[model samples]
Target chain A: MSAIEVSGLRKAYGGVTAVDGVDLDVAAGEVFALLGPNGAGKSTTVEVLEGHRKRDSGEVRVLGRDPGKPSGDWRARIGVVLQATSDAAELTVREAVAHFAGYYPNPRDADAVIDLVGLTEKAGARAGKLSGGQRRRLDVALGIVGRPELLFLDEPTTGFDPEARRQFWRLIRLLADEGTTILLTTHYLDEAEALADRVAVIARGRIVAEGTPSTLGGRATAEATVRWRGADGPQVRRTPDPQRLIVELARHEELAELTVSRPTLEDVYLDLIGERA
Target chain B: MSTMAVGAARGRLELREFFRRKDAVVFTFALPAFLLVLLGSVFSGTVLGDMSMSQLFTASMVGAGIISTSFITLGVGVAGDREDGTLKRLRGTPMPVAAYFLGKLALVAVASVAEVALLLAVGIGLYGVELPADPARWLTFAWVFGLGVVSCALLGIAASAAAKSARSAPAVMNLPYIGLQFISGVFINPIVVLPSAMVAVASFFPLKWIAQGMRSVFLPDEAAVLEMAGTWEHGMTALVLGAWCVVGLGLCLVTFRWTDE
Candidate 1:
């Protein structure tokens, strides 16, 4: 069953439409990525789904219940890590996590969540005293402390270094492996390609493309580029099938340092965002 | 997710934060005491020609409590929450947004009671201000004090919606408070110095009613000779203050946001 289903979702600020006729379906235990540029209605759509904003028109069902009219129990079943951390600067990390955990019926242990987020050493430290990356991890810890079935991650790693980003990906993968459905929105295409099982690209309040990382925009099956070093120097060819071209060149006994490659997810994403804009 | 539990959790969170903030505690408790001592001592010797110094000090001290709890403390706390996006984060949780206000009011009520107690002790010990001899007057004082705090706290919440930052919150809460203090006969008798328009405006605000209620307790019935009313007029002040409390709470309900802008 789909963990989240949104259809015909619409929202407007004054006369301008923020989320216009948007639709999405995310299956349970699947990692779904929503990719878009700024002002593309990505955050608006997510906010509506999270029940933080009222929708002008449309149906949004999370866990088969309307998100707009969610019961407290329904809310307890979902986790959200917002773009910013909580503002309780005086609270210690352990106190903050424990406080949030008490609201859920079947919450994970607070210490376990803190450990999962790699904040065990900073558990006694005040939230305001922590570094930005540490605070982001605390935000994640609070979100998952509820032991929710579905999770919303909004720009989860915007301020992290390369190593921290990689570590966060592992944590996300671990959550997904535990059968939690994840809906991710991010600007980093490499992160999406690395973590998402399937991705949907949104542009100007609409989905421009949707597919797996390798097959999106026919990236897997499109014409491949073949490159090699000949006696003359580097040579290149765009071909319908690079395998055939490489075999032909090999038959001539002249191809060296041969390589064949297809378009990456970023190439497809840029084209999609560019064309729609 | 339970409303009761969430309310309790919010209250606990507020208490924890309040105790954690040493600076906030210092201001919340010590500032009122310091002001009461300084003002009470400076004004203790002079009868100001006609008015007794203790009487005037008592009324003004009551005003100080209302302004401090309602405006200074509430304004800074709520505006700070808005600026830090704490209110916004709470909106995303299962905890009802109204619980935040409830928790804040609860904290303010307890702390304000402590503040009032501290001032009352000073009033008796140093200023020779007599406590009400009648138990009924003390009962009225208790009810009036509680309701007055409610009205002011609600007003503070309303004022904070317009405040841009924590630094500006004090000014937002104090602008009307300072004006109301004089018109309510806190620092000076209203019948002597206030204009009719000022009296009308003061009657509408909570400070005047709080002073009237406190005067009813502290002053002897014979002291009525000093003012036109000659005795505490409890009915009108209670009615107006009650109305303010109800309306202020309504405004808070209608305009309050867990996260706005």
Candidate 2:
């Protein structure tokens, strides 16, 4: 069964349309990345899905229940890591995780979840005292401590350092391996490429492109750029058939350490967002 | 978990936050103690024509404790939570918003008890204050304080909901607090020096009757001769305070936003 199904979703704040007729379906255990620029209605759509904001018009189902009118049991099945931390400054990491765990029916052991996030050492420290990276990890721990079937990570690594970001990606991979469906939103294209199995890019409140990272905007089968060291120091050519180019170069006797590469996920992302302008 | 357990947990957390800050702890208990001492010392031997200074001191000290815990502490704390995004986060949780408020009121109740104990210690040891020497009077003191705490705490929450930021919290709390002090006869004897507008305003709020109720509990039997509404009328005072509690709670429920709008 699909973990989340959002169709014909439309929302607005006064005169500005935040989400416009969006449709999405995320299957169980899939790490789906929602890629979008700022003001593309990504956060608003997430809020509506969390049952925190009312949508003007939509048919959204999360865990087989409408998020707009989620029962308490439905909330327990889904974990949400919002853009900001919970307002529990005085609570220790262990205490905060334990306290929130009480709200769920089948909560993961708080200590285990804390260890998963690499915050077991800082479990006794007050939330307000944690560093930016540690706090973001704590936020993740709190969100997943419920052992949710579907988890929403909204810019989860915004303030993380490179090492911390890599560690977070590993934790996400572990969750996905454990059969947890993840809906991740990130501005970092590299993060999307590394962790997301599929990505949907939105621009101006609409999904302009959706596919796997390799094939996003036909990047996998797109023209390949072949570069080699020639008599003039270097040589390069863009060809639709890299194999033919390599064969033609081989017929000339010495291919001379040729290299073939295609457009990266970052390049495709830029092109997709650029076309909107 | 039952709602009651949730409320208790919230109360415990709030109490922990309440004690963590040295400044908050000092202000919560110290200012009232200092004011009581200063007033008790300066007016110890003086007589306001017919009434002794001790009688006036006891009445005013009780009023101070009620106002401080209910209005000053509660108003500032709620506004601070709103500013810090604590209230918004709690709203998102399954933990009922009422639990947060119940926790706050529970803290106010506990603080009121401690405040009364401190006032009684100072009243008996330092100022030679008497406690009416009657069983019924003691009972009246308990009921009056209970009613007063409930009324003041709800009103404090109502006031805090209007406050936009923590910086503006004190400004928002002080005016109504001070106004109640003057009108409710917390500083001076209201009977002899009556300001018509102040009297009208005080009569409308629960603080004035709360003070009046305390005076009835401590003062001599003949003191009822000068009573405006009811002589030793615990019923009337309770009714007035109950009314304030209902109205104030309704206002809090109606307009209080867990987030900044």
- Pairs that collide, model 1: B224-B230
Backbone-clash count (model 1)? 1
Q: Assess every candidate by TM-score.
A: 0.90, 0.89
Tens-digit lDDT track of model 2 for B1-261: 666887887777777767665656677666777777887767666553566676666776686777787877888888888877676555445666567788898788877787877877777787766767788888988888887888788888888888878788888888877767766777666344666676777788777788788778777666665555537567878899889889988987887766665
Compared with the true structure, all predictions reach lDDT values of 0.80, 0.80
Stretches of model 1 off by over 4 angstroms after superposition: A227-234, A247-260, A275-277, B26-29, B48-55, B121-134, B164-168, B187-197, B219-228
In model 2, what are the clashing residue pairs, if there are any? none
Model 2 Cα displacement at B253 (Å)?
2.3
Q: Model 1 over residues B1-261: C-alpha lDDT tens digits?
A: 666677677777877887688767777557767766776666665443644666666655765675576556776788878877677666666666667777887778777777777778877787777676789977987888878888878877877887876668767766776677667776655344567677777767777778777766676665545443556667876898889989988887786655546
- The residue ranges of model 2 lying beyond 4 angstroms of the native Cα positions read A227-236, A246-261, A275-277, B48-55, B130-133, B189-191, B218-236
What does candidate 1's lDDT look like per residue over A1-277, in tens digits?
A: 9998888999999999888888899999999999999999999999888888889998889999888886777888889888975588999999999998877788999999999999999999999899888898998898899998999999999989999899899999999999999999999999999999999999989888899978988888888888899988999899988777787788776888888888878888889888534
> Where does the lowest 10-residue lDDT sum fall in candidate 2 chain B?
B223-232
TM-score of chain A of each: 0.95, 0.94
**Judged by DockQ cut-offs, is candidate 2 incorrect, acceptable, medium or high?**
acceptable
Q: What is the lDDT for B127 in model 1?
A: 74
